[model samples]
Target: DTAFPAVHWVMMGLNPTGSFTPADEAYTMGFEGREAKKEGDMRLLKERAKELGPGGIAKLYMDKLSGTFADGAGGYHSELSLSRDYGILWKYVYGTHRDYILLLTQLFYLASLFMSLYIVINFIKKDISPEAFVIMLFVLGSFFFQMIWEAGTIYSIGIYPYVFALCVLGLNAKKEGEARKEENDDVRKPGFRYGNKSGFFISAAGFIALIAVHLRYPRESVIVSVDQFLFQANDPIALSDGMEIKQSFVSDKDFSIISLKARNFEGQFNDSVYEVSLKDGNGDLIKTNEIYGKDMTDYEFTTMDFENVPGVTDYEISIKKISGENDLIFLYYDTGHTDVYPKGKMTGITGSDTADLTFEVYDKEEPGE
Candidate 1:
């Protein structure tokens, strides 16, 4: 196990490797300009597809869509790949899930821009300056960069500026339209005109809301569920012989309770109860706990608390699947490359590739100086 890195690789670099290397560095090194590079990539994909067949094509598609070259192929497997212009176009029209966030942002921005243009031309009664175009580019670029800064993809907040600006403009337009309508005493006209600014703005908001409902909300819910299973905020300090993830921490404040997600495969071994133990640095037992697979029910992580852990130094915690101790299972640790050392080695344990008992240690905090 490893302590969580102070900064995530994505935070330090646009590349997950945490470097400033271009995502398509492998594809673009020999080629120049955007079109030439794209053409070269297409050629490579075709050549590979012909050689590898459909499976290779599928793998290449996943690699291209992700924008990362994790598979050693030229294609990059970045989520950013799915959020770019072409990815979004394919997604909305074809209902593909290649990129998650870019399509909606692009649609909202384009709609707002077109709506603004139409209003200025027909209703604003003022000349649209050349500076507006420059401002639009500036706004778009700034929004685009901010997404990369926060997440690796254009899925978050990149569309907020466009949505906010459009909403404001729409409201102002509606106010102007209302004033004009009242002044004309147009009793024959409908109360809400289809051509009015309010209508377009409202439509834009509704469109965004629908997209949020269909995509963003569901995706977030799944992510939250997965987060519960993994210690994401900090890195695991160790992996038990059974491959259970472990970590060590020091509590500055007095607390006796702790919890963690059970390391069971989805729907496998969920009905069995496991014995858990907490021990002090002296190898003295402090508390014993138990959890059942039925109690976990689905992917919910099980938590156990030890009363009166007291403010102490060097505590160790362990969990063991006592119900089916004899069962043997093969564990596959992904080391990216097949020949990578240590992690790529075969299981030394006879019954399980993972440690039947997992352990996490916590250092005791010293009293205030």
Candidate 2:
């Protein structure tokens, strides 16, 4: 009776609570800055589209041309485009939505299974053998052809599952003699045969081919950097005077905040007490606060939150290695922090350094998802 907010928000906000179509998602994928967000978006779209029934998706895609999605951390990155960046997006989409789709596909598959079992039970009463039916069940449960395609995200992770389920149902209906086909093991039926044109295997193969063709895009060849870390900044944030956190890329309609990262704290040898300030080249203090730690000598990268206020110019970082490393000063501000929800709570504050930091202005959005 209880549903977690995570799934609820995903269904409501990102997926439009299943209202939007796959065509909309596939089209929206062309937006800038959508490389990461679009994965979750498309997953919701596909599942809903399937529920609505046939050709809705194909018709949607058929009506549109390839455009751009949201602006990424590095700017425009095509969706499902064969480009390197697009590949990263694909990997994410494949991994994230794979399980949900499989469960859905399994649901459909079970429907056919139940029907076949009914037919099989009647055939047995009529003195027909049920060995082939047993064998078919075994094959379906095994890690065979359909399942094999499920492993590598063969077209959106859900692709193989959906088509596979359809194939099973289609082939089952096409089974040569549903009235009494189970009578002989020596000569099975054409529709249920492994290689028959209308059989599940052949049907699945053709479906897979179509999926492959649909997924194909002109791949983009570009250099991938090896300097990626778990979390990072993708925007050159503009900090206001005394504004520790700014709303550069705010996703939440009601929540506004950004996660802060220390550029050098993780790799540094000396752990010390320091204060960071957001300012400009004029040495004026935009936002100034000292970072107090328990293990002054423990050098580790830590992330916290600061509100982004507009009109801020730059930032300043000052530190004292260890509990007493003769106060040292360091400074760095870069671009990025895609995900919503800020990290850490407010520790201490100064004049105008209220616990709740707010941005003075909101950035205007250009047309696109």
Candidate 3:
């Protein structure tokens, strides 16, 4: 998983020298000034060596060889014209600035991934109710603010869906708690109207609960699947470029029966495959199987009997296009929109997490079909 390496990088930032340098005398004493330096130099070397374990030393050498730093020689740096003044120079003005940037970005993504995984686990563990699941949908829907993070081009953007899903769970859970409190209170009671003190107090409580859950359990959960499809002239969200379309579902119940259906809008491609996978948060596959698409009729549901799956988070299903330049694939929407949604021209659904529903695929017919 990208997160393991990312997590290792967090330590790298705390002690940049440790990742690529050894804490041992052999490695530390070999530095440029150590041969003739004072005993104090030896002390400093020992301290640095202690901080930069063998892993750090090897990593530092690796980065140095790759030319991650301009002051450093060899490898990727040798190919570049370091003499020029540009973004690269600014990036390298400080020795370990890039590593710091990398560390921050990675930490942010790691946090999001962790949060998303937790929410997913809650769903799988039946820790959340259906109402809370709907709330998760709204939270993820609001997290489209990816445009703000590194212009929405960074790796964190990939993690936003997971974070957004969890946010939905948190926010919805809060809203429901408030609504229930309001219902119990008399309509004539003080501060019962919208935006009143009573509502505010309840809302605050819900928000606090959300935060508490986040902090109390900062552990990992399976990231069943995250799939994004932007409608391009040629590449629609469902139309694959000879790739696979995967989605994740979290189930709280262990069911012996699980099924999948993909809506295809053309002749049988004879090489389509439907796959179901059960995985952990780290993406280690637990169980997986494939169903051929050619066997099923177009626009029909094909059921597959998966083994009794353990109640867990991050169950994934994928459909592969073996050969078709432009095959009609299914697209799903959590909620319906008119103006914003492609409708008949294309099917546009709310791009958010709805844990209660099973993932489905369908073809677009008319503008809103």
Candidate 4:
């Protein structure tokens, strides 16, 4: 069975010939390279792989499988490991708002755990059906694989059916147990029975409470925007002459603010002047602002606001070091070929033509509209 699946995966290019680390590297390189030359970290990884012999490659593979590679933070599959912390997974699945939703999700996760334990206990007592036992095995196997190897929310999709099956089996077992208890005792339990007055009032009260809370606190409306920061921070573009980075964007609606991620290296204070200018489609300057290096924070978005800018579609933002002796300010960018913002293209970075600066464009929103 393993051999057949292994052969199939290899044929489909799902499984590569090298160890897991190299396989990840190959996949990233192929996916993000996009006909561009592999430079920087990608080139370094390829060289490092060639230097590693068979024994070294095997050790790396074993380390990743055992979840000991960089304390489970080294591989691409380490997303689930990192998200194991409290509220991290919830925030990833759901947006930052809606604390009530996070609490409900946590309750469901707890219920699933109890369901698993119930299935295991019934199986041990030889009271569960064969189908349920198989479903339990599949669920447990998926969990074990996540614990040992790579795990992500995406990987959990494959075992959703088994999980739903286990839930049904657990519910059926609970009802059957209740039925047997009633028959043996020859008496009916009185608490929270369906089709009863007490149950109907309690359920209605709960539903009304939920509705009240929802009406009192509605979810925040999220602004629709184009974000082109896909990959991790690449080599920062140093502020220098002839290195003026410009990002052009088009928006269907009116926009007043454009934010760019930047880093300040000069210890909280510097005497450098960073000029940010907004240019029109025909190379006409509309608005410009000068930001002192002392005011900028490290690895944070610097927002440049345009005043009295009406519904313009095509606009360009330029950032250059007007007065700075040393490289005090650096702009971050994405070297990968995301092409997420097709209406935008970044220019003025050395050694790369297709690279785009990490940026986000926000549409103007009116207050109390």
Candidate 5:
């Protein structure tokens, strides 16, 4: 079963295409400097193949397979290598900035994993049937696989039904054992069984407590600052080669930070880079900053700071894509043409003359302000 897929991946590596391959260059290139090395390896392999002729083709295939495996494994290693310094479970939980919802989800998953292991232990000690033991082992394997790989929730959808099935079987077995014990004993204890009313009430009370806590403290708003926007950018405009967007606005106050609503059309690890330039009324450059797509959160306002500029000054902001590989970055714009910033207008956006890029110009408060 696995052999067929293994052979297919090896064959795909020998003749790589943009579609199917043993290794994805984009995934591997997320790490710094790997893109250049991978490209160099490809070039060197092609040159060596030409020099060796027919004999080299065989070696080339093997070489390509080797490169694919090494690169693929290296990407995983780079991710796991960090766990050596920070423990695996710690890194997995806090690898990225996680919100309360995500944190709770991770905690739930950890709890489920531990509970599954506990159930498996009890099943083994109880000398359950071979088929039941095998099923529990499969569930344990799935749980461990998820922990080791740090797979997302979508990956567990298939295994969740099995986990639930095992839970149901374990509960039934416990109830049956209790019934037999009760039949042998004369006196009935005045305590709750595993799935009795008391258990339900306890679970309900815990759930209500969670809800009360959630209601008491709502999730924080995404926009927390009091900074003002020059114009609202409600629509998105994708930037490509030869495309430039310019916005003109008059400063209402002294501001040191300029923010643009930017979004990456690709994954967070994409290598897209964009350039933002600020020019005075006379068209002389005031400041220019380059921001990487990987550094900016998707669909959020990313800011660049500079020396404060006084109010009542006319300025123009230019935004364009500098360089990227197989990714697109979008700068948001206002489609309503409300003329919110009446002092200036937007230009160079495709298909609309009145669209203005969404931007916030403000001064950040210093500490203890």
Candidate 6:
């Protein structure tokens, strides 16, 4: 390395007949006069060596040499950017301002309870009996909301089927004046009215119970088969890119059997391998397996078995691999919605603290099917 000559303007001789030079000692001693400044500086550094610990001086010099520094830049204007979309930003800024969010949350809760009361009122007025609604409400109050944590979407869509089914059950008795009183007069006899009330009431109760179970212990059962999936083009409520499966069931037992035969598949997978896994909340290595293999060129198939697995809260499959793209298919199990639910305050902060019904297999048959 090239050395630069010291270019001090003052000389040691100019200061006094002393061992230290005036220019070198200028900033070395605060108020005390410098004495053998260069040698004294080295001695002072060595004196504090014991307090500084080994390598402390070396690290300090290294830091100075590298020009590295600790910056406090992360404290402000460093929050994670969620999205660049203006609407999303606007929503974040004002849509759920603290007060409004609290109000909405409260209203949603109030509505849930009010709707239940309304359901009960109409049920009694219609002179119907409990079928599934009993089980449904029990499950809802027990654990579905707090456990599953599926809000808004489930209520918006899930309540539809239950209401529609209940309405069908409710209106089945409402009849028009018959063209011929003798032929169309189907006034259920007073004695037979007991049976009609018994059936509809029992059904309504059962419906409530089914929804409650769906919310409480969603993963307990899965509908592996359906009679016929409602098509979006036909059923306006079923509108979505997702296909709906009609027949579904839940399990009361853990590690329950789930089997599905691949019905149909059509896709051109370029390079990737389809992957599937059962993941728990913490995302520890739970259970994973390759979904489809190369030999499945004709009609690809996939199956995974889990043993001694505790209750699961969520599950999904992904066509993922470093290679490129892939695809696979399932039978009536496709497009199944969430049934596992999270319930109560601080649900996410707690674990397996949710409540659910001990019964299973809520819906076994569809009327008129």
TM-score of each: 0.33, 0.23, 0.26, 0.56, 0.39, 0.21
- In model 4, where do residues sit more than 4 Å from their true spots? 1-114, 120-169, 175-185, 195-222, 233-236, 326-337, 350-354, 363-367
Of the pair 1 and 6, which is ahead by lDDT?
1
Tens-digit lDDT string for candidate 1 (1-369): 132122222232223232333233333445665566556655653554467566754553343333321112122223222211223354443223323343454455555655555545533455334544444455556544432332223232344454456545655665676787788885746655555577567767876776776664433110010011111211112223354322223333344445554334334544455666666656578888876655653323344556435666455555555564322121223333322222112223222232211211112222331
lDDT of every model, 2 decimals: 0.40, 0.34, 0.41, 0.56, 0.54, 0.32
Encode model 5's per-residue lDDT on 1-369: one tens digit a residue.
111222222222334231232133222333345454455445544554466577655555444333332221123322332221223343334332123334344444444554455567677687465655777778667654433221233444556556656656666666676799899988877674544687557756866676677566544322111122333342345676678888787654466778876555455777878788989888888889997878776557788874445643778888888887744544544656554445567787656556656666656443334
RMSD of 3: 25.8
Error at 357, model 6, angstroms: 24
TM-score of 3: 0.26
Q: If ranked by TM-score, best first, what sequence of candidates would result?
A: 4, 5, 1, 3, 2, 6
lDDT of 6 by residue, 132-212 (tens): 366346534423332212111222233434434444443432321123343566674466536657855775686567567
Backbone clashes in candidate 1 total: 20
Model 5 CA lDDT for position 98: 24
Mind giving the per-residue lDDT tens digits that candidate 2 earns over 247-328?
Answer: 2222212112222333232224534454545433344544555554332222233432343445543332222222433332
Tell me which of candidates 1 and 2 scores higher on lDDT.
1
Top-lDDT candidate index: 4
Better lDDT candidate (3, 6)? 3
lDDT computed for candidate 4: 0.56
